[model samples]
Target: MSDLILHHYPMSPFAEKIRAVLGYKQLAYQSVLMPRVMPKPELQALTGGYRRAPVLQIGADVYCDTALICDVLEHRASTPTLYPPAVKGATRIIAQWADTSLFWAAMAYNLSPKGAAALFAGTPEAVAKAFVQDRAAMAVGMTRLRPGDATAAYRSYLRRLANMLSDQPYLLGDAPSLADFSAYHPLWFSRVINPVMADILDATPGLLPWMDSIAAFGHGRPAELSPLDAIAVAAANTPAPLADEPFVDEHGIPLGSRVTVTPEIFGHEATEGELLAATRMHYTLRRQDERAGTLHVHFPRIGYVLRKAEG
Candidate 1:
């Protein structure tokens, strides 16, 4: 296995979730601090076009979407399992809900005028504007919650999470699982990135202690690697062999067919390549770029759409 390389920025909430997981697993990884906004050319070279933050690059395989990335990490470090068998189904279901619904609500509330001001406090006006524009582009096709409505929903969700912790230390149980990490990142943004808006958390007093406990994990050992260097790392290696699972095609697409895999919602950029594998859970594509050489980009089947590339 090539060195684990994470392409992320400092304030990305999803990236923070992955960082916490890495800490819990005590995994050492090299960090590539990617651009927080657009023109992530170096990172895109490996991912084809999937430009989500915190992409996990192992050898020449690029894992997009935190949902799939979490699964990959779980496979790599199975000792402290993210999916406990006792509540495995419940853990995944709640995690999906938290990652999408809870996350969007918290972000809408956190990026309100006041929260945005505080988050970009002291930053150059043009830089802040660029950041706002970039996110707006990503949200174009999605229905965003109004700030007031988002506040209500976020509060309600936080209360629900607090209720789960009535007897347990983490969301699913005494041990932290995927659900806890999914639930913590959005709240982490509110408290850490936009402290001005963190008072919303006070409404759920039980949450503070839980949040502190999760934060105690700390980001695992990370040494910085330049973006260019990270790309070179990809070019220097070949993707690991694909899993020996039977193709479980649902889209009528066969292996070796040229296809495009795109996110169903935000970050609609399509990654086009030859379909390599469509396992029960993920889709892998073989794509090549001059800078990154040949790579295998993988996406979870749940939130992405797979289509044959048009001529």
Candidate 2:
């Protein structure tokens, strides 16, 4: 097995989720720091164009999306399972809610005028404007929650989480599962990154203790790896072999077709490549770049759109 390399920035919420998972699993990995915004050429080379944060790279296999990354981690280290056999289904469903609805609401509330001002306090005006524009581009078609609406929704969600935590040490049970990690990251952003806007968390007394417990799981042992070196690692190796299962084609598209896969919501950049595997749960794209060579990029099926590439 190739060394696990995570390409991420320090402040990415999704990356934080993966970091905590790494900590819980006690796994050591290589850290490839990435820019917070666009022009991520090296990272894009590995992913084709799925420019989401916290992409897990193993040799030439690139795993996009934290959900899939968590799955991969679970496979890599199965002792402390993210999905307990007793409540696996419920844990996954709650994780989905946390990643989507709860995440948006918490972020909107955190980036409100006051929060934004605090976030960019000493930063130059141009830099702040660019950040705003970049995020706007990513969220083009999605209906974002207004600041006021987000506050209300966030408050309600926090209370619900408080209720959940009141009984158990962790969300699904005594041990922290996928639900705890998923639910913690967005709130982690609010509390850690945008502390100025984190007062909303005060209302739910039970939530803070839970947050503390989750935060205690520091990021796993990470050795810094330059982006260039990470790319070199991919270019030097071949992608891992795929399973021999029959192609599960739902789009009338056959295997080996030129296709594009993109997120249906935010960060809708398309990655075009030869369709290598279209399993029920995910899609694998085989794309080559001058610097990254032949890489197999993987994306979860739920939040992405798959279409045959136009010639």
Best candidate (score: lDDT):
2
Candidate 1 per-residue lDDT over residues 167-199, each given as its tens digit: 999988779999999999999999998899999
Determine the backbone clash count of candidate 1: 0
| Clashes (candidate 2) | 0
Q: TM-score of the candidate numbered 2?
A: 0.98
| Residue 263 of model 1, lDDT score | 89
**1-311: candidate 2 lDDT, tens digit per residue:** 23999999999999999999999998999999998889799899898888889899999999999989999999999979999999999999999999999999999999999999999999999999999999999999899999999999999999999999889999988999999999999999999998998899888878988889988988889999999999999989999999676778899999899999999899988999999999878999999899989999999989999999997
RMSD of 2: 1.1
| lDDT per model vs. reference | 0.92, 0.93
Following a full C-alpha superposition, what root-mean-square deviation does model 1 have from the true structure? 1.1
Error of 2 at 279 (Å): 0.8
